[model samples]
Target: MSKTHEVVIVGAGFSGMAAAIKLKEAGIDDFVILERKDEVGGVWRDNTYPGVAVDVPSFTYSYAFEPNPSWSRTFAPGNELLDYAKHCSDKYDLRRHLRFHSDVRTARFDESEHLWVLELASGDRVSGRYLISAHGPLVTPQKPSIPGLDDFQGHVIYTMEWDHEHSLDGKRVAVIGTGASGLQVIPAIAPEVGTLTVFQRTPIWVLPKVNPPINRFASGLLAHVPGAAAAARLSTSAATEALLLSFIYNKQVPFAVKSIEQLCRAHLRSQVPDPEVRRKLTPTYGFGCKRPSFSNSYFPTFLRDNVELVTDGIERITPTGIRTVDGVEREIDTLVLATGFKVLDVPYDLHGVDGETLLELWARDRKQSYQGVTVHGFPNLFLSPGAFGLAGPSLFATFDLCHGHALRVIKESRRRGATRVEVSQVAQEHWMEKMRARVGHTIFNNPSCAGSNSYYVDEHGDSAVLRPTSTVNAWLAQHRFPFNAYRFEEPSAPAVSARRRATRAAR
Candidate 1:
């Protein structure tokens, strides 16, 4: 007899871990979390670059269930964040239920049996009544095809895949792209490297990161005094909620937001003395168009004697240096491509139900889901922050909320004796069109800025990647799985034989 499980979660990231916790809380302990990596910590485990600190405040970035009473700092570093994930896994006893070092290659459902058969990287298969894909969209690194890229006789590394063993000391480094990763890496290794050259296509809006360490007094009050820690958590939550309110209802709260830009501009002016250099780095797009990065050190790094910020477009890579459009060759021993991930795009030719692949179905103009959970024809599947984007500063907090909400949907399906849950074509189309309409109204579609640093653009290069608006609103709206927005299908019938089950679907 084939071993069966209630659920199989792919990826042991924030979403998957949270899902396991929520499932356990709901008395559903028959699930197994399959992680590709040997250890836990999703993106946190992958990205170990220097000066890697989170932009979001520490208090609001944690799970509601397991709030940390002792946070070292406000803007937690990567080590702290990864430790928190490990701590969560331990506290929740999630490690025991995880199948580490296992990757899910493909998951196909037997509609009749109402079961998901998952194919693994090891050529083994597992079947489960439910399947959730928390693989996420951010980790996949996108390397742009530049001419003469591979032939360069130097260490070419993507920021996502950093070489911890390779020494950066005294090596001439060329850091490409100026996105979030770039912002983090530039300030960190700039002082250490021999000669650092930064190649930026579009300058992003930089904001000051108001990070602070938690004093012993504050920790004591939280640990000893009743409601002190609760009060702190409550205050942070209110502040985040206030910001979310402006985005959804007001859409133009100039005070709290513009003040940040003014602060950023002042910081930029102080760091970059040359007017032309400052002008080149300044963004003309609205503050929130691209992902607003918070850093106290990035601008200051540019001021370093060893760091050279180059504005010239990179034409190609030569034998020794990068050949810019200006025909200037900047010599470098190491190349770090911080070109960012393929956000608006996913892996190749992902086909869903009726043989309609996800890339083909949503290829034309939009990426839609029925309440950011399920898509039409793609039954027995769910994704974190899918149709509607997640709001708030912390992806961890957002994923925890999403996982809780998705757990409800799962329980609902089980309770109602659903063989497979699916979204109606009408619901999927309506949701997609409505979201696109909302996106059309935002500054994300700013007529002036499209090509520069936007992953929001679709395959057509329109800033269609994200709505180009409020992160808070996107987070709150996807808090729950709108059951009415989807359709549920009962299992066709339990198959007595494998041949019979295959025959039913192939027809």
Candidate 2:
């Protein structure tokens, strides 16, 4: 039998690290962090494709408490982000709590023991009083269901698991999917590849990027100056929040949406000289239907003589190349799948009260939670980014808000000496209804977004990912949400006390 811990956190990325730090700060030290990979950085550690850099500014991307003063660029590269993760791990002593290469297969709640039991891929079991799922939605890569893809003879690479061993220099390459990953990798490999063909299912709104180097003097000021880092973070956060709000409240702020559309159109017109090429690159959907990307080079790469953009629908993959519905087969030496991740899908199995699985509950009803942190049936389980949980574009801010709410519950449980804590079904239902109404006003629900193919919309055709509320309101909700909404229960059985004694004795 595995010894039970106070808390068990999955994924050692920024979210897990933040949870661990908060737990320690709250004086709860008996916690374990389970990481599937050997390293700490989650997406930054995995995605090493060429031209992989953050779309958001570096200042806002980092943790508020621990800001890096030496970011070389406005938008830092993936490697630098990984280095920051390592630095944070060492600085916070998180390595001691981390269990590397521990892949969680399933998590089931043990009602009798009032504990969450995690079964790992290695057939190991871990028990914890509280479970925090820090693994993000983008962890699982989504492969395009193109027929005859396995029949391809050439090397196939996923953007998530990039193969640096095989050189792409002077090789004919074909990239599928025009999402964020596709946008970044296309420009990076275009200059090196012999001939590049980009297959686009849907066009993305591309805005001009303003990435400037932060020199030594500026870096020093940000580091040594008392208010410099705070000021920078504040300004960047404010700017991004304003932009995100305009999208969330498109019905209320029509002018902001129109302004953004005009700016994107002007940028596309300025970059691509050919009118026909520009038409193919432009998105018919309204701005913010899908997440917009920033790149000065993506549009210009199409102008290159070696690059070709194919807007035709993909029919199937042949032995040597991809065949479009237009009946053209573009032979290529390598196939790069820049297809995005399964954002709306849960990757692992999770069982809650009375053998009710999370998948079953979501399928029966819909993916929802009280605060995007806690669900009704899943007691003592907290999700960092739950359904309708993400508060803003900046993931760091969302982590702060979500984890802050989780910590409050954990602290309250400790104070009340409660062994089990779960949100009331009534409370969850009320929250879900409010969220549904709020999401209706966002641009995602607009008629223009019907063909956007955005991950924000779930299987039920609801925009269930984003919180659809302002960041300020999210923070207020975290602090001011009534604790009475949860039902806290103390240990009622002798077996539970005996189990705790056994766990302590084993430790």
Candidate 3:
């Protein structure tokens, strides 16, 4: 029989690490973190494409409790983020609780036993009193279903799973999808590739990247000064919150959106000399409809003699190159898919009460949860960044808020000696209604967003990505939600009597 732990956390990414750290801080140690891969870093470990760096400022990207004063740049490179994950793991001593290469195939709540039984791909079963899923939004890479993509004879690369072994030097490269990943990868590879062609479906809002190196003096001040790091984090967070408000309440604050659009247009005009090229690069939709990126070099990369932007629809990918609807075929030696990841959709099978899987429930109705942590039928199952759970732009801040909520609930369950804890269906529905009302006012529902192809809108035509509330409100709610919203169940009388008899006999 598998030994049942007190808690089972899936994924060893930053979120999972944060979960483990929180559990330990709350004096709960009987927990195991199951990681599918051999390493700790989740997305950071997987995505190693060229010119990969965090768009969020480094000061605000890290945990509030564990501030790093040694960031090389304002927007640190991908490897630095990976290193930070490792650093946190080592500092927190999380390795002892981690089980690497343990891919969870399915998680089913055994109501009779009041525990979550996780079936691993290795034919192993791990049971726990509580389950916390930290499998983040960007776990699975999305491959475009372009016709004849498989027939391409040349090298192929997905931005998430970039192959550094293959050299792009002097090679004819074609990149598809000009989203966040494309914005970064294009500038990095354009100068090196012989000829580069970028296929665009929708143009994205590009802001100027103001990344700068952290000089020794500044680093020392952040490290040695009393409140330097905290102050920097606060200021950066304030700026991000303002930006998020601009997206969430675009109708109420139209000037913010207008200012941002004007800035993007001015940036485009200043960078690109050709009006035609600038027009092709401009986005037709609202600024906040789709996620935007910051780049100092993306616009200038188009001006390169060898780089060409193809706005025509991709008909199909031939054996040698891509064919457009205009009947033009561009021969390329390598193809890079900068398409984004699968968001909101649960990537794995998670079975709850009555054998109803989370994927099935969400697909049948809609993705929702109470405070983005607990679902109605899922007992003691906490999800990080669940539907409408994202409160802010910074992922680290979101992790802190979501995990903080989960930890508080788990602690409450322990306080009451409850073996099962699930949110009330009424409470869950009430929360969903609140989110729906708030999201209705956001820019995601605007008519201009119809053609943007924003992932923020789900298949049900609902903006289920963000929490539709201010970060401050979300943080306060995490600590202030009523305990009656959850149903806590203790063990049966017979089980309690048996335990009492066993204790007496031992004594």
Candidate 4:
């Protein structure tokens, strides 16, 4: 079928859904939300592992237009969160615009038409005037190269690609990596397993998740007063951003990083009676240096008699057991790898601007974008959570901010009668340098945490993925789509440029 939309969105997660809703609200229905999965909720729909929950509180994790007053928990689990995404999609009439199971294999920029040609998996080609890549970075799975892993006789499961049919009841389980996924998976599987051995590459600071139920009275008040939820979102976003700044912007900031680390250490020491276990679990790096985890139950779960924390690096994987660097062989019936996603890298083979793949273009430079939305050489293409994906305490804040930012830019482009707009290389380079400098000051890339392998930092040891600001700040700066920072072409020139791009695209 030959059809075109004014706006074409990839990935129906928070960003895509929010974009669709925003576009519809602005009376732009000639758009489509393309998703590879049969349903919406991109990552949330895919990752259904036990103990998988949002790191932030539920009150501010959702879209501003729709709030779930009835969230069962402060940090809603993966399933509930997915349900919330779907609920929002349905509520805002976004499902009608979603083309489920439509995987866009390649997006070619047609210079002549001043549009994007999306080649889908179903052998259908669609065009859109504006392309929004809400395709988040986390969907890509990264597996470790453990020798003999393929020969494992027992069931092996990767956290991202969780197997619903597989059960760990009464089985000896060996969990690998103590990252966010590790903390979540361990808590869920500890009780069910006959024995649970956790493999930790590096110790992580895990703060107690002070998650509590959203009170009924508060929900009612929010429903009536309205500003209550908005106020909570504002307050929470500020607090989260402040924490980030303390770690990076002001390492000397009083009680900034220490406060959280101290709390985590205390929790670990309190939970584990054995001094040896506590030592093994405690991180050597500054707490905020790594992606700090939040879970009150993770430590308590490890303290159980069945759980064992193994800090030794892995030597190799045997068919029936794992051999640690210390030559200790831990036999288990199942291997659960909590290895995190490719946060710094964009996995898809995406090529933009004369056949330069996204990875290759950003290889030496880490990722450089003006305000995390517009990149150099990619005209009319906007990415959600792009270079400065890290922003706001809540993903919802980032989602809304990005959607709002992109919409404002789109409107500004239309108002100026511009067909194509790309961020200036100078602006992008300056912005990228600033972010790299920020990461350099933060605890995440400090010397202590440098040796630790984490998806948090890039090859250049920069936290370009996260924005070190609040949603309000990001929106304030990006709300109007800085045309001054961009070089916009009149409609005629872009059409000619489009023809050239189309010729290159054909090649």
Candidate 5:
């Protein structure tokens, strides 16, 4: 028999670390955090591209409990953020509880035993009373399906899995996809590359990324002054949450949209003076239709004589170059794929009760969950960025809120001595009915999203990513909502009997 733990957490990233720290705080330490990678930091650890940094501001990106006073800038770089992750792990002594390189092949709930049994890649089995899927949406990297990609002769690399050894100095480079990664990478490598060709599938809204360093005085004030950092975090959170009004509340973004467009236009006009090029770079979609990127240097990078921005669609990939639909074949020394990740859909397999997989359930009913955390058929299972709950202007805000709710449920179950806790189908239905009704009113459901090629909207053309609620409201709902919405399995007969005898003997 495999050793059973109180909880088994998959993915030792931020979410997993948060869960572990919260569990410890709750006096529950019999949990194991399994990470496939050799270290923590999830996407931060994986993505080490030329100009990797967070899109969100630094103050609000961090956890409220562990504020980093030494954030170098308002938006810290990827390495700095990764260091913060390591610091959190070290601070909390989470290393002792972590199992590195322990990749989970599959997880199944043992109905009769009331436990979650996970199979590792090394053919090892681990059982636990509860299971938490902390592997976030952007864990898996995706490459575009282009013909002759495998036959490409030169070096091919992904932004997530960056090839650090391969130098781009004076080398002709062809970059595919102009998403967030593309926007960041293009500017960083343009000055070094001999010739750079940027393939734009769709133009994304680019805002001014004026990242000013947090001065030493301010850093010291935030660190030394009581409640200063907290105040800054609150201010940033409020601002981020304010963007949600533009995202879901208003059918049109109103003044926010116009103001943002003006800023983008100014940025583009100032950087790329050529009218034709500016027109080619401008996005036709609404402000919040697709993920808006920010960068002061991105638009200006194209102004370089060696850089070429190609708007034509990819016809096919040749042995040495990419042939566009316009019959233009751009020869390349190396190919870099900035092609984003699989967000709306997770490729990993999960088996629940009666050998039913999550994919099968989603296939039958469409992918959804109660409060974007719990699934009906999956007992003792909690998911991050599940279904409709994935969205938040600040993902960390969402994570903090969700972690509190999940831990609350776990604590409630433990208090009741329950063997397992499962969300009822009726409860899930109630939440989804309300969520979908609210979805119709949001901008995500708009036709503009599909036109923008946003992954936020799923294959069904419905907004699958966002939770359609305010961040504060989400936090409140998690705290105020009734845990009775879930069904808790009763303790074993033997345990109950033993407890009764002990009580009688004490009397």
Candidate 6:
């Protein structure tokens, strides 16, 4: 018999840690967090490039339950954020429940046993009553499918898996994809590199980053003064929400969208000071069509004589450099793929009841889910911020909502003396209808967003990366959702007695 846990959580990132902390707070400690990596802090730990800092303000990006008073800047750097994750883990004693270096290979439902049978990379077997997938969307790095990529003789690295050992000092560097990571990295390395070339598949709209330092006085006030950090969090959250307004709802209103566009254009004009370069940098897409990046130095970096921006499509990569569609070749010493991750792709296989594969089901069903947490055919399994566009301006807010919804379902199942819980097919269909109706009205489906090449859209030309609703609306829906939309089942008589004892002990 395999060892069984009441709950088995995959990925010890913020979502997994938050779920574990909530479970312990609810007096249920019979759970385990399995992390593939040797450490926590998911994205922050992985992406340690030159200018790696969160675009979101430090205050609202952090958990409301555990506020950090020592953030050095409004937009905290990668290392400081990793330290915050470790601090939370230590403070909450989550280290005891973590299983490090335990990469789960497979998780299949054992129908007769009423448990999920998991196989680890080390060939260890484990079973759990409930399975939670907190492995976020940014785990898998997506390398561009370019010809002769391997033929390159220079040191190549992905921004996600940055090569810290190799230094770029006075080296001729080429960076592909001018998205979020590219924006930050270009400015950070332009001064150090002998020459920097940025390849642009699509231009991005960049807003001025309000990244002021948090001095000692502010840190002291946040630590000692009650509600000081809370106030800051609220203000920052409001700012992000305001920006999200035009993106999701008010795209039709030119005035609403133009206000933000003007800000971005002014920011660009202020930095570049060259009309031709600024015109090339300006994005033709609508303001809310793609994910926007914020930076104070990205625009300025392009103005430097040592940097070159290439707008042509990459035909192929050579041993020495990249060849553009225009028959131009730019030589380089190092290649850095700042291409984004596979957000809509599932990293691993998951099998549910009757040996149903989740990947196939998602493909057949257009990768839809109920509020980005539950699926119809998958019983006893909860997805944290489901594959479909459940992300928001505030990731913390989005994950918290999904966690709350999933936790409520788990708690309600126990309350009803049930061992299995599944979202009804009717309810799932109803939610899908609502989701499509809401998404159809948003800017994601607009004609302007069609050719933007955003990862947010699926192959079927539908938005798959963001819930077409506001963060506040998502929170309310999760809290007030009907629990009866799911079917709950009681265990066998013997198992019922065991569960009763466990529940009593937990109390």
Range of the 10 consecutive residues with the lowest summed lDDT in candidate 1: 243-252
Consecutive 10-residue window with the lowest summed lDDT within model 6: 385-394
Clashing pairs in 5: none
Write down the TM-score for model 2.
Answer: 0.98
lDDT (Cα, tens digit) per residue for candidate 4, span 1-507: 457788999989887888888888877889988899899988898888888888877776787677667777767788888888878888888877888888888887777667888888888987888898888878887788888888888898988889979889999999998888888889898989899999888877887777778778867877778577778767766666777677665445646777777778888887878888778888877666668778878877767989888887899999899999889998889999988888745544556767786778778666777787778878888888788765776666777777777787777777888777777888788877777766666666566665566666777756677776545666677665456787776668656777689779979
The residue ranges of model 3 lying beyond 4 angstroms of the native Cα positions read 494-507
**Can you give the lDDT of residue 506 in candidate 6?**
75
Model 1 stretches with alpha carbons more than 4 Å out: 237-259, 344-350, 460-484, 494-507
Better of 1 and 6 by lDDT: 6
Candidate 1 per-residue C-alpha lDDT over 1-507 given as tens digits, one digit per residue, 9 for 90 to 100: 236788888878777888888889899999888887897888788889887776667777777667676788877888887898899999899988988877777677766677778777887777887777777667689887888888889998887778989899999999988999999999889878999999988898886677788888877877788777767767777766554433333235445555656877997997788887788789876556577677878877777889888988889998788999999998899999998887634332334666666656666535677655666777777766564545454566557646755776777788887767777888778767777667555555545445445776556544433333354454555554377766676655445466476668879
Ranking by TM-score: 2, 3, 6, 5, 4, 1
Clashing pairs in 3: none
How much is 167 displaced in model 3, in angstroms? 1.0
Task: At residue 37, give the lDDT of candidate 5.
Answer: 92
Q: Estimate each model's TM-score.
A: 0.90, 0.98, 0.97, 0.92, 0.95, 0.95
Q: 1-507, model 2: which lDDT tens digit per residue?
A: 466899999999999999999999988999999999999999999999999998888899999999999999988999999999999999999999999999999999988778999999999999999999999778999888999999999999999999999899999999998989999999999999999999998999987888889999999999999999999989888988988998799888878988989999999999998999999999999888898888999999999999999999999999999999989999999999999998745567889886878878888888989888899989999998888888865999989998999999999999999989999999999999999998888999789897898988878887888999999889999999999999999988786779689779979
- Candidate 4 lDDT: 0.78
lDDT of each: 0.73, 0.91, 0.91, 0.78, 0.85, 0.85
Q: Name the 10 consecutive residues with the lowest summed lDDT in model 3.
A: 340-349
Ranking by lDDT: 2, 3, 6, 5, 4, 1
Candidate 5's C-alpha lDDT? 0.85
Residue 177 lDDT in model 3? 88
lDDT of 6 at 8: 93
Candidate 1 TM-score versus the reference: 0.90
